[model samples]
Target: MVSTNPYNDFLKECQMALQNSIATLHLSIPAISFSLDAPPSPEFGELTSTISFEIGKKIKQQPRSLAKQIVSSIDVKDFPLMSAAKFAGTGYINFYANFAELSKITIDSTLALNDAYGHVQTEKPKNVIVEHTSANPISPINIGKARNPILGDALARILAARGHAVFRHFYIDDVGRQTAVVAYGYKKLGRPSLKEKPDHEIGLIYTLTSCIIEIIRLKLALEKQRNVSTEIKQKLQMQLEDWSSIAAELKGKHPRLFTELLEKISEDKDTENLINKLNQAYEAGEEEAKGLVREVCQLSLDGIKETLTNAEIFFDSWDWESEFTWNSDVTKTLKALKKTGYAFQEGPVLEFDADKVAEDYKLKHMLGIKDDHEIPSLTLTRADGTTLYTTRDIPYSLWKFRKADKVINVVGMEQKLPQQQLKLALWALGYANHAKNLTHFAHNLVTLPGYKMSSRRGRYITFDEVMKEAVKRAREEVEKRSPQLSKEEKERISRIVGIGALKYALIEVDPTKRVVFTWDRVINFERNSAPYIQYSYARSRSILRRVKETPKKFDYSLLTKPLEHDIIWELARYPEVFIISAENFKPNTIADHANLLADKFNSFYTAFPVIKAKPEALSEARLGLVKAVSIVLRNSLSLLGIIAPEKM
Candidate 1:
């Protein structure tokens, strides 16, 4: 079970040949570590090294002349992986791969590796914990929050494929003000039997609780300020009127449920105080508060789980945020931070001195913040003794470090400051190594074309609805193009295409850029999409099916076309591409490579004949090439958690 990367083999040979050439020519240079990378274009050769450009200045000669001199000293016969070495364009040393040997070995290795084609093992595999998709359990997951799980899932898959022991974690943020509000409304409604989707039902309660309480409070204030200024009276009246409109809208949608909650909430003497009690009790681990909140949280979680499972996303562990507080881990971490003299009290609030810690450790530059910029102190606990989410995360982070060597938190970019402060907290608590190993895998936002998402307004689209729309649109596309397929097959293919389309839409773009989720781009069959790549893979499969056994007298050297060479080089580079994707925490790199390879394969298939070529040996070689493309495409897609369907 030897894993072979033909691209690396060629790269190494090129590097060795360059090193030997430098030695053979009696050049006096410093000891150098040799490496080669892909040139800007395929015509430049399979790989390029700029050593001559580096040393030409040192040795006082023109770069092109130095490169030409070095090329003549190397004998290609010694390094069979490389066919030729030459000076290309003003100083660059380029190496041409022997595709005749590369194609044979690349295709043969691909066929042998099969499912494990692109996994290149590292010398030091780590226990990596990826915590992601920690969406609040007060409601169903929305489209705005969908990107986290998809990117997180793809990252875990890539890391695991690359031979790391990867664990996926979902942090259930159950102990929070939002959950307390929803639980309060649910309790007042007698915790009625949920008829609608559990999360949607809970969400209605949350919205109702929020609006009704606001309206009630505003009215009470207006009543008390009867003799106040006209401006103050008008301000209170306007807020009351706004909540009234929102309540009316909710009442129109679910009259019975809204009426029930509104009646019970209006009956309560101090509803806001009750919610505060619930929040504090839950954070304190009171049994009554725990039962009520956990019940509502579990119901919401069940609905969320269904949505994620639809997208084929799952987690290895569901870590409870409250568990840290209950087990006194948060208290322990606070004590440890206090010993470092960075903890101080401001009135009733306790805060961590993140700025002082950064200055003390000289970490402003390493943490990527300017020395002139002040790192804001973090609030550890509120006046009411309830810890903040980031405070709870401190102990949870400690828990994760106990299990793994590295931890990657896939969170939104908006939490950048909080993440930085958490890292400094680790250093303050004497876990500086863990702080160094922690990564904030921050991603940009996802925006719809003409829509804005606001969770508090209850106007956000759910992930479940978007997934259904995608599947429906895919079915139409599948029916229009592949009418010959049976109904069941069409349904299955539609799901595969739709799901893969959504995943690729979120994943193909660089994480630093916002994803513009548009239908035309997502379901595009022409280019740069999952369906296009998937179809190209299917075309290869169909071609292979049309051919019989490969002729024993095949000549891989017949694949001499530019497009053929491109696909061959691409097939050989899958392992290198895979390793890059895994190490850099960028699954988009794999998506980009797969799309490029598919485009090349499609172009080659259109211009060249595979099954009906004149020579039997050439046709056999072409079929072998098609098979190699299929394997690599499927393997790359798998690393992104995409299914490569064999048919349209």
Candidate 2:
């Protein structure tokens, strides 16, 4: 990789040395992974690996002999890549780059790429949908909710930038029991909160209703402990029943009000009647259901607009599930599945041999049911002959197949089972003819250290609150640092720095790991944090701000500092960082690169002066170096969905 990486021509010679060694020893290791490694001390080279040990194992020989055999085969025509090939203990081979060559390449390539620094071609732009930030319809997005969306959205940006066809789907888990709780509270004691406008209003009502449920629970708990009369307890029980019934009815009326309702009632017989009632309401132009659906749709649209506009996250289209179940489409899909024997009518309900059909699905393991388990007696049609959610989704998956070559679902890991089952059921129903193209991009939840964020229990943090706190904190930091800065500049910096810190903190970790929100780490100014990277960028800009002359030519010969070489090497690998981030669906790679670059650059900045130097040529070269670093830092930070403020 370093050999092909334009900046390091010496890498080609190093690669040839390794290759020639393989050839001379009559050993044929196809390729070696060239990497940067840190040894216990400086006695070891800057970069090294134990490739010799791996080769030894393959050839069935002692590691020492193999290391010697490989070392003897190396050819150093110009400068030696490493000081000496040493067989440390059990067959470990270590190599280091010549300082002069490494420095030249690092500086030259960084200056050469400029803003277009990190562009790399992908193997193939496989259609991927990194479904993330799939928050429930509990309330507005929170700090925890921000992690998935920002991570997914940034990954999509990096992948698409690298020539991958990435489709980012912000999954809204609107149909569940969680929504049912909100609907129940709304029906009983809560009024619609119109402050958030359409969608926000629903979130507000859900939040308040959740709080109301807690109060009711507490009251009931206390009443049970008291020495109350039997009649009073009975009356309280009746009221509780009434509340539960109202909640159930409300859930039936508005599916989005509770996400868990769909999971619970997905296979229930009552689903058909519910769907029939919903469709009847749709057909007769029943004002209430239609009004509610429209209102919810509006809320979703409004929220999408707000987040996308304010946060710069955009979606090309809102693919609606109901639209796919249009009269002709649903009828045609059902008929086709039935003809294919994927769907069969049995005892007035439609059933599919899901267990027998799972062999073809890669997500089979994710599906809750096993091969021996009876194909779930899925209710496609109720006793009253009404279509269910599965009926709607089968056609919906089919519709996605028809529209795109691949479908990527950005959803939370909690829904892994349902998503898996849904995919399997789709194939069994014959709707998902191109089922192989589907991908469920699942991510772990972001939880507080001591508590879980539950919308049902009304125990959750709002995104707005997190943003406000971040900005407020950033403002305080800025004022403390520069009391002379105007209020306007402080506000501007606060927004960028605060939001940038939040986004960076979230993206800096693997998506599979649960995010524990910690303000200390998130807002920290030192070590592997957003402010650290931002400060580096700002420091580079600050250097340029004090300079007047723009150097037409950089004296690459003068750039031989160890710190400079390290920074340049990190900068030269920006393209690779982005490639890894996109390929793995992890934006943390970019975040890591930024931190590495900043660390190296900070060392370089402190050791050598860029703006003030004795030698004119060396000063110009160092200034050119800082400019290159700035370009890369900006690019890398932007990839992580973070802002690079010139001054923070």
Candidate 3:
């Protein structure tokens, strides 16, 4: 598949002529990847590469001699983009970018693509499953929980725009123990019937339990004294009663594996056979355990729906882990793994074979792993013969693999190890084809002020709260600026722009970097942020409002100014940015690019009055610039899962 990239084709042709010149002059060197170089002033040439040093090393000759030899073979007509070549003492080859060619190429490329300006259909699109924002059974969707879904959803949108079929999945960890605490409270504590506000109810329970647990820890620390008073011990016993009561209620609802730990803590006794007991119950189709899990699972799903709605995140698929237990294909996968010896039956745990580790350190290094490192042991089935989360995932992974050429798991970095292990386990079990295409799109944590967000205790902000705050602030700003605007109009624009700003702010940072949520930065109408881009788009619309001219069909020829050229350049680069962002799981790159384009357009607007310019030459050119800006801005924001309001 030797495909020609449109941008690179012209550069390759130019490089070929340079290569021929070097050969004709008997200079030992090839053209390198060179675009442009400039000093503080324009006196320096427009393009630069280090050909002199390369040739000097090859020919055992002075770089100056090689430089002279190469330039002597140049035919001016063959290298029209280059006015002259000059080599600095350090073997630098500098050539100027021809202004005439730059103008023609820039405008020509922009006009050719038109509305399809920045997109390149690089490959046949395939279905992509992006599973993200699988936060624990927490009551609130905090600022920290907000990062993954925003990035994952944004990436999904970008991939889909580039012709890939994208399916977004938002998984909820209902089976996990953290949610168990809340469930346990409901069952054992005679809790309030607050299913209508389940998240809030759970949130309150978790908060109270957490405070009590801390006090219990402090009392336990005091008990380390040589002699403990009976009075103090009795008080500790009372506290333990409170803890047990809460844990029992939560456990009665969720029946989580970790509930046994809470049980041991309350009883002050270790149960060594806890896993065995639980596994036996699970395998025997214990109605109580299954019923509890199912009930809590349903509640968690309800909470998830509200959370996502509040966060403005949507999913194409909400796969249930329980679905795989009854799936015949899951058994087939387990059998295949056993046959391949990728998974061997230990007394209780199913372990991945150590012999399967790839000896090729280079390959491991490429996958960002250190030497002698291997994925952790995977337990597909318990000793009692019930399927675990890993087993359930296998069928889902297999389905995704067969459906698409690639499958992306947009999960937290904490799950990176498990993700790698899952892939290895799946591959060992005869899901080799799917394993090869799996990608773990890991992202860093989103931290609140002075603390990391924890869903287990419900000690975080809810997604609804974040949106509400943004909308409130936005409404006030709208009223201050546009008081005459209708209430309905203000509300509509507020939600769109405010929510758009929040999503973009979270996404503008590299997903792998920890994000510190801040109201000022998110709503800042300044550089490298969502508001700046939105404001830029709105400013362009405002300029067009004066012309009273319906946006005409675009004519790129009128876009002649340097500012116009700059905006066009950025707009043309959109497709490349989209491809890179999707490939690298980096929405920040797209955000940054959009920011740059807006900044350039703003600069252009300041220098040139679009509406006030001559009707034929300036008006057409300005109109074209504004139209292009509007299209690119809307498209960029759309990729971030944001809607652009025309009037905002």
For model 3, where is the 10-residue window of minimal lDDT? 1-10
Candidate 3 C-alpha lDDT tens digits along 1-648: 111122343345446655787767766445553343333334554445566677678768787777666666765567544446665655665554443444345444554455455555657778788777766554655677778778888888778777788888765554433444455444444444565556655565555445444445645655764286677677676766765665565556556523533443355322223323433443344676556555655665677677677656788877665455444666777787788766777888676563364332133554566667764577777555666666666777887776677888888888776676677666566555677789888888778768886654445776777788888878887788789889999998888777877888888777788877677766654567676788888888888777766444434456666667567556545666777776666778888888898899889988887777765655765676677677778778888887777776
TM-score of every model?
A: 0.94, 0.79, 0.80
Clashes of each: 0, 20, 7
Could you give the candidate ranking by lDDT, starting with the highest? 1, 3, 2
> Where does candidate 3 stray beyond 4 Å?
1-13, 16-20, 23-47, 61-115, 176-182, 188-197, 202-292, 328-332, 342-347, 354-356, 359-363, 379-388, 548-561
Candidate number that wins on TM-score, 1 or 2: 1
Query: TM-score winner among the candidates?
Result: 1
What tens digits encode model 1's per-residue C-alpha lDDT throughout 1-648? 234788888888887888888988877488554778779987788888888877887888899998998899989999977888989899888899998888888878887787888788878899999999998988888877888999999999999988889999999999878889999998998888898888877877788787788787798889899987789899998878877887788789879877888788889898878988999999999999999999999999999888889999989999999899999999999888888999999999999999999999999999999999999999999898888999999999999999999999999998999999999999999899999999999998677777666555566778888888888988999999999999999998899888888889889989988877666665555689888889998898888777666543448898888899999889899999998888899999999999999999889988999888868778888888888899999988888878999887
lDDT of 2 at 490: 85
TM-score of 1: 0.94
Candidate 2 on 1-648: residue-level lDDT in tens? 123254334445555666677777787755555443445654565545566666777778887788777776774444443445555667766666565555555556566666556767666766655445545544667666677678767877787778767666544443333444444444333234455544455665565454435335645554775786676666667666755664565455555645443334333334323534654454233566545544554564576457655666776555544344434566666676677565677888776555455755544555545555554544555454545555655666666665566676666777665565567767765545456567676777678899878554445676666766778888889989867878888888888888788778777777788888777656555668888899999999999999886686767667776677666667656766676676666678888888999989888888888767858888888887898889889988888777888887
Our model 3 lands, by Cα RMSD against the true structure, at: 6.3
> What's the C-alpha lDDT at position 248 in model 3?
61
Global CA lDDT of candidate 3, please?
Answer: 0.65
Q: What is the C-alpha RMSD of each candidate to the true structure, in Å?
A: 2.5, 7.2, 6.3
